[model samples]
Target: MRFSRSRRAFLRAGVAGGAFLSLPASIYRTALGADVPPSEKVRLGFIGLGGQGTGNMNAFLKHSHATVAAVCDVDSSHLAKAAGVVEKATKKAPQAEKDFRKLLDTKDVDAVVVSTPDHWHALTTVAACAAGKDVYCEKPLTLVIGEGQAMVAAARKHGRIVQTGSQQRSDARFRQACELARNGALGKVHTVKVGLPGPNFKAPGVPDSTPPAELDYEFWLGPAPARPYNEKRVHYLFRFFWDYSGGQQTNFGAHHLDIAQWGLGMDESGPVSIEATAQFNKEKWFETPEVAKITYTYANGVKILCSLGKGGYPGGTTFEGDKGSIFVDRSKITATPPEILKSTGGDVKLYVSNNHHGNWLDCIKTRKLPICDVAIGHRSATVCHLGNIAVRTGRKIAWDPAKEQIVGDAEAAKMTTKEYRAPWKLA
Candidate 1:
């Protein structure tokens, strides 16, 4: 799918460093402000429409302030199905295209929801920002570390609002739990246990098959190295492959790790050292580990342990402190000593988002940062990416948070950003 000429022109103009082409402030005021609330209608475009994309679209549909103006997907079937869902819900048919760049061309769209796979996140998001559109991209924020930094730069340069879809940050229960830990209500927090779901396990072997016609095979590969499409390498199962994603580490780690960072008051920063050990099935079809343990040591002397386990913990953050330990997940929160739960503190400020999509909508109107801003999301995602690097290299890594790079390891540094496929630079 190619970009339309008009879209390319619009993006080209907005890409002049930090100088965004100004639409009149009154245009924004009349369209976004106003007592009747300027239609309360924010035209939205969706980039990926798989299982996750469909769910995210539905979430946005619930917002009276958002309308699905356009949709795009690499798979035609997924595109058609998602468009139907949006039409049924909104009673308004959105323009559907296989090429995502075309959706970016639509002047009616003020924001884009990128539900694409990990490799595509940075590319789609940077393009959206260059097009002068706000973006809500799924986590982990980047497939690689440098991409995360590039994403932050692009968003800032274009004066665009970008939200990472680490929804747990917007949850009241999760926010309250993080605040409790941060405010010392849980006492001197020493360690945090971040649990994520196990890796994808399949039979020992499956032969790669011909690409599905409904899918744009090359386009889907995007910036990742070229590989033939296999059933195991597409759809939800793609999470198991390193090329497309970092398996459950990034898939689920993005959520749990972000919460762990927030609880430790390290959202804007990250650990300086990391070491990891992972167990992989040498004979299995999966490329990622089935079980692993990673330890991260922050400059402030806090340690975070992230692991994969079954049945015991429900994959959330456990903050252990001198006073007591608090365990919080999606369903509920529990803490030891019980008193910690009842003790309310002044700094336990809740993010107060009834829903994740609504928070982005509100921020778009207010021009404030969303609960999971780009920088915070990038830092949390860096932890997950670094853990994978440690495991893969079998070496302890020294990281410079301010520079956002691995220290003293040229080999490790090379992994920070991948070379894009021809004619598809990260910029």
Candidate 2:
């Protein structure tokens, strides 16, 4: 796969921190305003048409105020299926392209749904913001902490609404649970327990082989290190590898840990120290930990114990306070005393959004921050990334949350950012 000349130049300008950030104001419309009629639908471009991408497209299609206008993916099969779904639903064929840059170049696309792999999220999102379109990027927001910082910078500088796909933030059960913790319904929460599923890597080591005919292997690697393609190294299996993702630590952690951060009201800041212990696969089939336990100590003396594949703790987040404890997951919200669930949260209201997709659309029109805004996503992801750092290093990590640095550890600090492969840079 090759980049178009204009798209290449667009990226170069973005890398240089020049024209991409300072484009004319006229080119920056989000396609909806007072001048635009109320009945006008917001046009969305779908990128990385994997399972999640296709599902998001269907969610948006259900709303009469939104329409799928474009679809992009490195895989021809995925792209074709996405376009077909749009055509079948709206009776209008969407502009299908193999490159996301071309889809961003389309004049009619008001926003983009980025459901690509973790490594590609930062680049596509920053570029989309530079190109004057809003973004709904999938969670585990960035591959690294520095990448998350770059994304936050791009969104702020471009005045764009960048929503992270941490949909649990919009779920009522999670909301009620967080409200209980935040509103003193739990009576000074001191300990939070978060349980994450273990990595489910089943494939054995296999020889590297030629890329699939329908897939753009090099492009899929993107900013990730160059390596021979393996059957287990792409698609769903990518989560188990360190090169592309941080396994279930970032996968389910992005959702569950995000809830922990929200319930603890640590959206803007994070823990001051972290310590972790992990055990990897005995057979060497996967890279990330098979089972791990991490402890994060916040400045206010709140301690979050995160266990991956640890048998004792239940799945999801549990806020343990002096009075009672509240446990919440996708299924239900349960409290210890039983009466705590009856309280109306005592006016310590949190951001209320029952629908994640619809919240992004609503924020696009009002220019308000979405429930899972990019900054919040970044902070939550930073917590997950820090846990991985602690696990990989096998040591306690002293962190300066205000400064966002790994205090006194130069070698570990370098893990916060990574060098991109040639021709791909984040400014």
Candidate 3:
């Protein structure tokens, strides 16, 4: 579980302002417009080979200009599956490793794609950046508010390109919806309605059992409190447990709420106050909320009502303005007073990224910012985490997005940062 010498040194340097930030530029190709030759195509190492990880790996494999140089996972089964898919596509076997730290030590890996569960996101991302590798990490960006900020700080300090996998940001309809709202075509957006799915915990009464031999349970639980292995506690089911995820709140909310933040032009800021009410599953099966309704009001008086499974409307983000309203989800977009749809969204165009994965690759080569940059992703995730904090504490929390702190509630503010379990720290 040892990190590379460079990664160890970087970790020892800590998050102090000037340590990693001052590293000589000789190690990185910081220039823009440099073409990566065929032989020098971006070298990528992938960690966390689950469903989303495999999907992202497939997308990267489709990129002719990139190489899937390595793969890592705590689950032997998942690692074998990913290796099979990668080998079939590239006609070359990817170097495999069980510990992500070992993968970081590989000199050939120029960038890493982190698709680990929420708890592992910040540490993997920070370690990768410190080791001189760029990162494309999956969303909810971090499990807690403090982790999000640490992730932003890490990427900034190392001058690395970290793209959070909120792929909806790269979709066409979502982009156009945000553009319309931003350009005043929406005529002063006053409200944003977001919807999330309900909790679906299938293992409510299941008993804990020994973990499968194919899985490294200890490593998977890194940074999370120790718990007995249960079939329902790993993989997709991990979303239901607060130790690893924020349930549907951070699950689907990360997507829809992110769009709400984007359309409202609040990517750099957040709501002033939050009001929420949540219900837990009767079975006490999961730690996250069962059903919740959270409302966030920005400083400008814009109010957002997020309904989980109770919006009465479909599951998606809707931007409501004085003049018109636009409802858009992953599948489609609709505009009321439909003629407003024809209006030119104005000259202020957001980044055009038809493909999120391709967008990351292009930015990696050019050293340009991708559409959903780390800071932007962190801001979006902050909104989600704050909503959860409000739900869990059952209090209307006031926030200072600039300071990234809860305004008055001492107990609630502490939830912003969690105590890591042990040796797994948020470096």
Give the lowest summed-lDDT range of ten residues in model 3: 11-20
Give stretches of model 1 more than 4 Å off. Answer: 1-27, 30-38, 202-204, 310-314, 348-350
Candidates in order, TM-scores: namely: 0.91, 0.91, 0.91
Q: In candidate 3, what are the lDDT values of residues 1-427, reduced to their tens digit?
A: 1124564344333311113233234434443244545555778999999999999999998887688999999999999999999899888999999999999999889899999999999999999999989999998898988888788778877888888899998899998898899898879899999989987778555889999999999999999999999888789889888899998889888899999988887776899999999988787777788788999999999999998855435799999999999999999999998877788848657767898998787677666667777777888888999999999988999999767889889999999888999887877
* Residue pairs in collision within model 3: none
Number of the candidate with higher lDDT, 1 or 3? 3
TM-score of 1: 0.91
Tally clashing residue pairs in candidate 3: 0
Best by lDDT: 2
Q: List candidate 2 segments past 4 Å from native.
A: 1-39, 310-312, 345-347
Encode model 1's per-residue lDDT on 30-120: one tens digit a residue: 4333333534567899999999999999888876677889999999999999889888987888999988889898888899999988989
Clashes of each: 0, 0, 0
